[model samples]
Structure formats: C-alpha cells, structure tokens
Target: MTLEELFAPFGLKAPPLRVLGLTLDSRRVEPGYVFVAVPGVPLPHRKPLDGHDFIPEALAKGAIAVVGERELSLPVPYLRVGDARGALAHLARHFFGEPDRKLALLGITGSKGKSTTASLLHHLLQAGEKPAALLSTVGLRLGKEARPNIGHFTTPEAPEVYGFLREAVERGLEAAVLEVSSHALALKRVEGLSYRIGVFVSFYPDDHLDLHGTAEAYFATKALLVERSHLAVLNTRLPHLKRLLPRPHLLFGPGGEVWGEGLREGEEGLRFTLHTPWGSGEAFLPMLGRYNLDNALAASAAALAYGLSLEKVLQGLATFRGVPGRMEVVQKKPFRVVIDFAHTGKSLEEALKTLRATTRGRLLLVVGAAGERDPRRREDIGRVAARLADKTFFTEEDHRTEDLQAILEALAKAAGEEGGLYEIIPDRKEAIFRALSEAREGDTVLLAGKGHERTLERGTLALPWDEKAVALEGLTALGLGGGEHP
Candidate 1:
C-alpha cells in the first residue's frame, strides 16, 4: 500500500514512499520497510534502547520510510505522528486489510489467568466445531496447528499482531482469542483492533511495576481492554473493578451471569456446577485449583457471548485437559507433585491454598522470583509460602544478572519470623531434588514460578530447563512412579 493510502485512516497525509512492510526493530528492517522509532520503557539494570537511535541502521538496512514522533532529516521519506506506536498499529491494520474485521477477536486481559482463559476459549470454540485461532503466552494456534511463541512479550508488536490475524484469515479461521497484556495496551500494540468480546479474569499487584510505575496505573492499562471491546466479560469477585463496568456487561463469579457452585476438589480434579446466562450444568474439570475454575468461568462466559450454548461450553470444559505449566500435574504416586507458573503473590497464595486443602499430608513448596523485574514480589511470594506451606524452599528463578544470594535472602526475609520450616537453595535443580527427597507419603510438592517454560534465564543466558521433566527425574530417582496420576 502507498504511504498516503495507509495514513488516510489516521487523517494524516502519507509521505511520498511505497511501503512493503513495517517494523519497530531496526535489525528486522528490510527493503521498502517502514521502521517505527518508538521509545521503550527502561527496566531495572537495563539501558533504555530507543528506536530513534537506530534510524541510521534502519536506513542502511534498506528501510524506505521512517515513522516517529519527531521529524528527521534523511534521504528516505519521514512521516511524523503524535504517537509512533499508535501510528504503527494503524499502518499494520491497513497493510493487513484489517483482518480483525474479517474474524471475531476475543481478548482476555488481567494480571493472571490470561493464558489459561484464552486457551480454554480457543478449545471451546474448536470443540463446538468453530474455526478458531489462539495467541497466548503458551503460543499461537491456527486451525489444528500450534507453535510456541518465542517473542519476549505476551502481545507481540503491532505488525505481528495484525500479521497473525491476517494469517488466521487466510487459514479460514472464523475467530481468534488473544491474551492481551497490560504492556501491550499501554504501548498501543493492540491499537485499532476491536474484540468481539473481552474478558477480565482477575487483578492483582504483580509484575511490570517498572514500566507502569504504580499499581493503579497498571490496572488502568489493563482496563483498556474493557473500554475498547464490543462486549465486556467481568469477574464480579473482584469488586474493585466493578466500577469500571458501568455499561452493559456479562458478569462471572458469585451472583454473576456465570458462576460455579457445589464445588468439590480432589486429587483427580474439580467438579462444580457451572451457572451461565444460557443455562447451568455440572462440569468435571480434570484440572486442579479453584482459580482454574475461575478461568473456566471466564472462558465459558466469553464462549457463551459468542453464541455458544452452555452444553457446548461444558463439553469443551470437560474434554479440555489443561494449559501447560499452569498447575500442571507431573506425577501422583506416594504423593502428588505439581508444576505451576505461580510467580505473583495472588497466584502463589491460591495454588498453595488449593494444594493445602487437597493434600492429606504436608504441603511442600519450591518457589522463587525473577530478578531484575519486581523485587517487592519476592517477599510477597515468600510470605505466601510461609503462611500456607509446611515446608518451603526459596530457590533461583531467572536471576538475570542479579545477585542470587540477595534474591534468596529477600525471599527468606519475607517468609516471616514465625519460625516456619524453610531453606534457601540457590541451585534450582538441587532445590527440586531436596524438596522431593524430603517429601514423605501423601505429601504434595509444588514447583512454582517456572511452569511450562523450557528454559531458565540466568545472567543473559537461556539455559535448558524443564520443571516437569526435572520433577519427574527426581521422582524416578526416588524409585517413585514417573507416570502421571490416572
């Protein structure tokens, strides 16, 4: 598309340039590409790398045009906009033929449960025989094909977001489910894309404080999903967010349009009666934790909003196994071992609470926090473990360029002075081994923080790491059954 045609939607005259593609990263610039020089937020221990500094590099790489907030003197065409990120979103939408309009887009945003909810909705739509695609923390899916999303962010850049939807359109997919992050909304990565339905699962003070600066700002960024969506699916349990939904919306949780009752938790899974606007039905989810039930409710509400029946939603929930790394069961023999991505205090508390209820014996926790992100959450994680776990092991989890001992000590300090049984293990693999070795019969071991992630980030290096495999190996070494519990 010509620059004029692309910028027409934004009411700005396009420069005299032909664009073949768009990118934010200068390294990815190619012939006839329009590079956007958007400034990025600086995180802890990292220098702010602005795209404006790389204009020369982009030009050298054959970028035909540049989009930025400031005008630049260059041989190539320059298009100035109030917000470069928003401009990229508009350009991407125009370039991709506005694929979101061709397909039904469902966006799920919150501090947690995004991946599981998005995946569940995708599974439900597919189970109902509707052509659907998924973009989540786990990966991307179109039709029957799924692949891991190697991008560092949950919601990729504007180009990638529209590009994926465009591909979904080509694949003949009728709908798409996306796990929209607060950063994505704040950065305008998902700008110009409208969702058929948006789901707010739950909120908590968690990661990305460095970018957002405050908990309220973080929440406001997430609240954008509700504002831009055609319809909002809200979790009524979080009363603080209720005021954000003054307009018409579908509610979930207690006394909401979709809620769960008659809840029963066991080693096998959970059995609950799912209440929806359409109707109500008993759902036996082969997944652990009440939080998962919340995720199920969110997905069910979204699916029902898309014209799916309650029976189909229940069937999809029943047939669905679970999302990888989110409360995944590794083994069930003398005791139970679960791997979960419970990095936040809220998620950790919920996971431990559920395990404590179901576990007949002691609840053992192996948890840690990522370095160079939010240090405050480190203590919160420790405090949660201190309150719920019979024994806790504070170990290394993605301590990129940060002092390992300092991170462990912070966690140990937050564990409180109640004289709880805890240990500081810097080595993650050894920590898992020690936890498993100390476990007696009927004890439930939870390996939290690193769930389905296959690698461990340590000081700018991504080492091969698998929590489930490591737990299974530890079980096998103890002569316990490595197979999953039936």
Candidate 2:
C-alpha cells in the first residue's frame, strides 16, 4: 500500500510514497516499510535513545516514509505527529484494515487480575458457543494456535499487538479478550481500537515507578480505559475505587452489581454465590481465593455486557476450568502441590492465607523475584512469604541481565531481617524439587511465581519447564497422580 493509504486512518494526507509494511523498530525496517519513531519518556536524569537516531538507519533500509516525532531531517517523506505512539496505533489499525472491528473486543485493565480475568472471560465466552480469542501475559491462544509469542514483556509492541489481533480476526474468532497493561495504555497501543466492553478489575500499587514515575500516573493510566470503554465494569472492592469515579460504569464486588457472596473456601477451589445484573445464582469456581471471586465477577460482567444471558454466563462459569498457573494444582501426592503466579506481596499473602485455610499440614511457599523491573518488591515479597508461609523457599525468577545471586541476596536480607523462615536457591527447578522433597502427606506446597510459564529463563537460555508437569512427576513417583483427594 502507499504511504497515503497507511496514514489515512490518522486523518493525515498520505505522502507520495509506497510502503509494503509498517514498524516502529528500526531493526525491522525493510524496503517499502514505513518506520515510526516514538520518543520514550525520559526517567528523571536518564534519557532514552531518541527515535530520531534510528531515522537514518530506517531510511538506509529503504523505508519509503517515516512517521516520527518533531525535529527530524530526513530525505524520505516524514509526517510529524504530536504523539507518535498514538499515530502508530492509528496507522497500524488502518494498515491492518481495522481488524478488531470485525471481532468482538473485550478490554481488561488493572494492576492485577487482568491476565486471569482475560483467560477466564475467554473460556466462559467459548463455552457459551462464542468462539473467543485471548491476549495476555499467559500467552495468546486463538483457534488452534497455543504457543505464546516470543517476549518477556506482558504486552507486546503496538505492531505486534495489532498483528496478533488481526491474526485472531483472520482465524474467524468472534471475540478477543485482551489484558491491557498500564504500559500499553501509557504507550497508546489501544489508542485507536474500539472495545465492545471494557472491564476494570482491581488495582494495587506495584511496578510503576520506573515508567510512570508516581502512583498517581499509574492510576491515571488505568482510568483512561474506564473513561473510554462503552461499558465500564469497576471493582467496588478496590480501596481507591471512589477516587476513580468511573463514568458509565457498573460497580462490582462482594455486594455490588456483579458479586460472589457467601464464599466457602475448599481444598481444591472455592464455592460462592455469584450475583449479576440478570439474577443471583450459586456459583462454584474450581479456583482458590476471594480475589478469584472478583475475577469471576469481572469476567461475568464482560460476558453479560457482550450479550450472553446470566444463565449461559453462570453455566460457563460453573464449567470453566481455571487458568494454568493461577491457583493451578500441580499434584496431590503424599502432599499437595499448588503452583501459582503470585509474585507481588499482596498476591503472595492472598495465596498463602487462602491455602492456610484449607491445608491440614505445613504450608510451604516457594517464590522468587523477577530481576530488572521492580527492585523495591524484593524484600517486600520475602517478608510476606516469611510471615505467611511456614516454610519459605526463595529461588530465581527470570533474572535477565541481572545477577541472580545478588537478587537473591537482597530478598534474603529482607526476609532474614524480618524474622522470616526462608532459604535461597538460585535454581528454580532445584527449589521446586527441594520443596517437594520436604513435603509429607497432608502438607501443602505452594510454588509461587512462574505459575503457568512454560519456560525457565536464565540469562540467554530459555529451558522448557512447567511447574505442574514437574509436580505431577513427583506425585506420580509417590504413587498419587491419578486424581484429586476423594
């Protein structure tokens, strides 16, 4: 397509240039490609490599035109935009033919519950005869494609994000439930796409200082989704929900528009009363914790808003198997092994508190910290693990470009200073094995972090690994791998 055709979506006149494809990264530029240069938000005294530096490289690669920030001198056609990221989103939509318009789009945003809620919402919609697609930290699964796209980041780049959505639409998917991250909102990835229903889960302050610089900025990023969504489903349980003042929104919680009351925690999952706009019904989730009740309510609201009846939605909820790694059970051997993706202090506390209620024996928690993002959470996570877990095993969780031992030392110091019971093991697999080896019948071993992750990343190596699979191997060795406790 010509550059004019590509820029049509942005309401800008296309330059006299032919472009074969579009990209923001200069490395991916090729002949007939339009490169978009987006200036990164500088962090305090530090500054990011400006997109202008790559304009020359992109042009050298035969890029016909460049959509970039102001102050650039290039021989090729260039269009200056006040917000380059927003322009990229708009251009990509037009270039991809606005694929999301053809597919049902559900946007979920919050500090937590986005991934799990998106996964569950997709499951429920598909169960109700709505062929659905999902894009989340867990991975993208559309039609028969199940392998996660290559990346450690929760949300991919704008082009990749739109590419995945376009692929889902091409596969004839009727619905796409996406986990909209704060970074994606701040970067304007969802700037142009229209969501049929937007669900605002709950929020907690974590992993934002580096990008957003402050808690208020993080909160504002989340609010953008609520403001733009056609039907906003807010979690009334959030402590700051009042401050958000979500418009065109229906509140949900333990006693709100969509809720799960009378919750009864169980050994495997929790059974609760699910209340929705249509009617209230008793619902049983094969997943643990009160947080999951909120997740279910959030998904229930989205499904209902998308036109599924309360009966179909509740039926879907009843039959929906939980997402892997989110309160997922790995084994029920001589002991029970539960694998969860709880990395935050609040998440760990909730997981441990929930498990402590059901476990007959010692509650063991194996957790680790992800390097490079939020260093502040290291000690906090360790402290929480020590306070709640009877036995805490600390291991490495994706220490990309960071020293694993150094990271572990930080956590160990925090945990030790707090009088927490914990041990440091740099290898996550070894930590899991050690936790399992220490477990006895009736004991509950909770493997926190790397819940449904299929790969164990270490430096440049990504080895195939699954917590559920490893725990099952141990359970089978113990002769208790057939089924759950009867």
Per TM-score, the best of the predicted structures is 1
* Candidate 1, residue 292: how far the Cα is off, in Å: 2.3
Provide the lowest-lDDT 10-residue window in model 2.
Answer: 40-49
The number of the candidate with the highest lDDT is: 1
**Model 1 residue 421 CA deviation in Å:** 2.9
lDDT on C-alpha atoms for all candidate structures: 0.86, 0.80
Q: List the residue pairs that clash in candidate 1.
A: none
lDDT of 1 by residue, 1-486 (tens): 887777677666767567789999998999989899998777766787788999999999998878888767778767788888888898899899989999999999978899999999999999999989999887889977988774657899999999999999999999999999998999899999888899999887656788898888888888889988889999987646666778668999987878999998877778999887698889988888877888888999999889988888889988987888888877776888888899878889888988888788999999999887878888788888888899999999999889889999888888866456799988999999999999988899999998878789889898988787888788888887544564
Q: In angstroms, how far off is 327's CA in candidate 2?
A: 1.3
lDDT of 2 by residue, 205-295 (tens): 6656678888878888888777777778888866567765635677788567787778887766668877777888888777778678888
Model 1 steric clash total: 0
Backbone clash count for every predicted candidate, in the order shown: 0, 2
Candidate 1 Cα errors over 4 Å, as ranges: 1-20, 30-32, 42-47, 205-208, 240-242, 416-418, 476-486
Structure candidate 2, residue pairs in collision? 4-14, 20-32
